[model samples]
Target chain A: MTVTLAIDCMGGDHGPSVTIPAALHFLRADRKARIILVGRTEAIEPHLGTALAEFGERLRVHRASEVVGMDEPPAQAMRSKKDSSMRVAVDLVKSGDAQAAVSAGNTGALMAISRFVLKTLPGIDRPAICSTLPTLRGQTHVLDLGANVDCSPEHLLQFAIMGAMLVAAVEHNERPSVGLLNIGEEEIKGNETVKQAGELLRKSGLNFYGNVEGNDIYKGTVDVVVCDGFVGNVALKTSEGLAQMLATFLREQFSRNWMTKLAAIFAMSALKGFKHKVDSRRYNGASLLGLRGVVVKSHGSADAFAFEQAIWRAAEAARNRLIERITERMERERSAA
Target chain B: MTVTLAIDCMGGDHGPSVTIPAALHFLRADRKARIILVGRTEAIEPHLGTALAEFGERLRVHRASEVVGMDEPPAQAMRSKKDSSMRVAVDLVKSGDAQAAVSAGNTGALMAISRFVLKTLPGIDRPAICSTLPTLRGQTHVLDLGANVDCSPEHLLQFAIMGAMLVAAVEHNERPSVGLLNIGEEEIKGNETVKQAGELLRKSGLNFYGNVEGNDIYKGTVDVVVCDGFVGNVALKTSEGLAQMLATFLREQFSRNWMTKLAAIFAMSALKGFKHKVDSRRYNGASLLGLRGVVVKSHGSADAFAFEQAIWRAAEAARNRLIERITERMERERSAA
Candidate 1:
């Protein structure tokens, strides 16, 4: 079975320069995948050059008449730029021409367009932006990264169900546990929705791990950590900020004195090992989970390497039929929510 | 005039075992500081052994008849445990026997009793938990760490005002800038409260630096970062988790191989310097700001060194008269909110 992905070729900071190379890289690596490059032919063609002959029929281009600005608001972008590369790419997924859609464009615009085009899964109130964070044990899939700002108890439960399905499908964790993100691990902690979610999650058949605090995300104690988008976004961004700060501090420390600089040279391999453990680019792909179809969001500023990673992620989701898995799980459980 | 602090010696995990030593450590470091140990005298007396003579009149114990268990519900603790060491300690601040109160007790209980006893500063709707986070520049004061879970736009503006004043008073940073924490820096981003708060913050007389993402907290782009309690708590805890994870990973790397162990030995001083730079103890004290009187919250499981840091923080806040500064600033600037 061919897992075809629609690439939003004319979005984000680097546009075709990154997406074209990414699409080619993904196609070359995955023999069972195909990509439809959706953008202005002239802009995309300059970069596609030998990739067309190399990939043969596996890769093709679809012309899009308009482009969505990176800063454009989601609702306005969805309404005005109906023929934009972002919209066209999502449309391919809706039309069954592609199994998934991948974009490095305006996050809000992509979400809005995709939701409008693909619609939400049955029994899902709001689709969450789920992403992977590197943890001490391995990796954690945290949901509601910023797609929905305000969520109710029902929304949180749906997120857990969807998140569990995503993990079980992609990561192949047979009994992946879900943790409710709270200030403390106790059942009594957290706000109203969190408390209510705890109660509902306890009753659910899924492997529910009572309640986990913020540190649990990095600890990798659970496969899925659930929260409202507002808290999730703050946590994700806070970690990103701290990571960057630590990196900067380490660099400054290494250069502080000649002796320290010499020590850094001696410890290069060890430092690289640490860097690889927390590398930002390694966790760049964010799944726009809960959409009726598979859609992966690449970081807006992702370079070729990161964009390629996102494409691979999209292919993986398509291969796993992640949307079906989520729908099936939601249908089986949490239908009452 | 001596600045007196009321210590809830029977509060935290180790109770007097931690708080007594912390208070003594604090007293030894600063001769001018006085402490009214507010707990059952019998519980605190054993730990105050030889150091009691060195401090003499500056160190004394006050009798409190009740204790609030760490896991007790906040509302219940507030109502039933009026004579708790936590309550009596706060009462000392109210009656002017002490200028400040320090407790490593239950956070919810502390906030509840502090708000009930000290009340909110004039023009402030809610009291917020503000703490310092080490950044590249120095430190950032982030507010609403776990106070008001649900906040209005006006409440956010008020937080910014109170946070700005707290920074100005405690850090002695004149014209300190305030950043509204958001998912993104764009004016159009974030939920309704955030958007509304951004508009109000732009007009706020305080040095507003526009919307700052989570990374800005560690970047020290602004002296104060304001958010509703839910986001702030998650951000703070998430950072804690990440910091711990990083420390663990570094330790593992150092011990992974004999060669890396040799490299670690060579880089011992530099590594220690880096550890001290981000040490959790250095950022231990959390100021429960926007109260009628100064209250500093120590981490529940804080060791003697960390609890001492909290005591010093409370002393500094009292000496600076943080309440008057916040009251005056809020009256002058954010009365409309």
Candidate 2:
């Protein structure tokens, strides 16, 4: 399948310097893919150099005059930054010029813009931010990272269906198990919303794994873990905080004294291997599930290699017809109901 | 002032094998402290051996005929296991025989029994689970870890006051800064409850630090972080899961080959130092705040040393009059209103 992705070339910390290079790398890696670079012509062109010549019609730029600040408020950005690169990227998907959109901009702004432009699927109440985390058994996809803070039980059930569909499309697992993220695995645990959501999921005709705890996400106990945005966001950020603290601790220990420093030298190769396995860069892309079109959000601080992975994820999702799958599944549910 | 702690000897996975030894170690360490070991006499006697003789009247055992199972339901344990060791431990604290209670038991059972026996302090609706976590600056006290899953703005405000008092007592910090845990630091972020809680905390007269994200917990941005128990518990367990995954990845990396094995040998000391710094056992005790009597919950899987740390925490809180401090704070708030 031929996949076309609109790249938000002016988003993220490094802007065109990182995004343009990543778009070029992604174009090279995926032979059946095309990219529309959306940003200021002057800024994005400088980084594209000879890639345009080599790829010909496969790569091009779509000029956008404005850029959204990393910390800009979502509503303000949505109202004012109409010509922003992030907006134009999502617009390209809406305009049917691209099958998917990718951005490494302000998460709240990206979600706001994407939801505004692309809208939600027919049966989806809200779009959820879904992302993968490294697990001992592989990886698990968790949804509602920080989109909707206060979600109803129906929203959680929708999130579960959307997450499961995304995993099925991206990971090619037809019957990916869905787990309701709760404090305990028992049925009696959690608040009223979660308890009601659990009941909804058990009858949702999906491969439900009942309720799972926070540790189950890393244990890879289920393929897709569904939660309200508030809890999911806290869990994701808490993991980020802890991983950073442990890394800092390890670095301090290795550099403490002469003997430890020498030990770090000898352990360099193993440490590098260990670092590669747990690198957050590998898990850069976060899928904005439940949207009408594929929209993947990259980490704000991602480097070129990491940003390319985001593009790759968007491409994979588009190629696998993620939106169509979710649409069809929702349609089936509605028809059955 | 002499502080007496009631230890639940037949609780936890190892029962008296872990709790009795921990109690003896605690008795030896605290010259001004006494312990009442509550459990079946037959099971508790063998572990006491020479410790009771050595410590004289400072250590003594109070026999309880029944034991609460680790996986027993909280309500069942409270209703049926009236004479369980865990119940006897809280009973001693309730009767003023001991100033505090320490238990390595089912958290729900401990909390239920403690609340049932001693009751909540005046003006406090529910007790909170407050625990210290290792942070970059030093340590941060966070609540409510797993006590009240669904908390209102008022309940969260109570938690802030209770957590701040716990810090003031144990850490000897008269004015500890408190942060409301939210998805974002902006004033307009989070659910209605959190936004309302932020407003209440701002006017709470405590050292409120506005809103903080999950990462702020480990950054030591504030001395105390207060959140609804559901969010706090998920964050805590998510951290545990990520840490476990990273550790497993590191072990696998170091044992991959002969060359890596050599590197592991060289890096052993540095690794040990790093491990010791982030050891969960060092931060074992969780204070059950807002109760009339001090009660600390140890990890159910704690060893002798870790369980002793829980006892030490109970002793410190009792010595520092944690309950009285909270009670006085609540009284002042109520009077001010």
Pick by lDDT: which candidate is best? 2
> In candidate 2, what are the lDDT values of residues B1-337, reduced to their tens digit?
6989999998888999999888887777779899999999999998878988899999888989999999999999999999999999999999999999999999999999999999999999999999899998889999999889899999999999999999999899999999999998888899999999998888778999999999999988999999999999999998888889888989998999999999999999999999999999999999999899999999999999999999999988999989889989998877876
Candidate 1 DockQ category? medium
Q: Model-by-model lDDT, in order?
A: 0.89, 0.93
DockQ of each: 0.70, 0.87
- Which predicted model would earn the best DockQ? 2
User: Which candidate has the top score in TM-score?
Assistant: 2
Clashes of 2: 0
Q: Which stretches of candidate 1 lie over 4 Å from their true place?
A: A203-205, A334-337, B79-83, B199-204, B333-337
Predicted candidate 1 versus true structure: per-residue lDDT over A1-337, tens digit per residue: 6888999999889999999988898888889889999999999999988988998899999999899998888889999988999999999999999999999999999999999999999988788999999888999899999888878888988899888888887888868999999877878777888899899899887899989888889989899999988788889888888988888887888888999998888787788888877777888889998888999999999998889988888888888878889888887785544
Return the interface RMSD of model 1.
1.1
lDDT of 1 by residue, B1-337 (tens): 4799999998888999999988998898898999999999888888988876888889889999899998899999999988999999999999999999999999999999999998987778888899989998999999988787778988998888878887777789879999999988889778899999999889878899999988889988999999988888889889988999998888888788998899888787778778888888888989998888999999999999999999988998888878888878877784554
| Model 2: per-residue Cα lDDT over A1-337, one tens digit each | 7889999999999999999889998888788899999999999888978998989999989999999999998899999989999999999999999999999999989999999999999999999999999899999999999998999989999998899899999899999999999999999999999999999898887899999999999999999999999999999988888888889999999999999999999999999999999889999999999999999999999999999989989998998989999999888777766
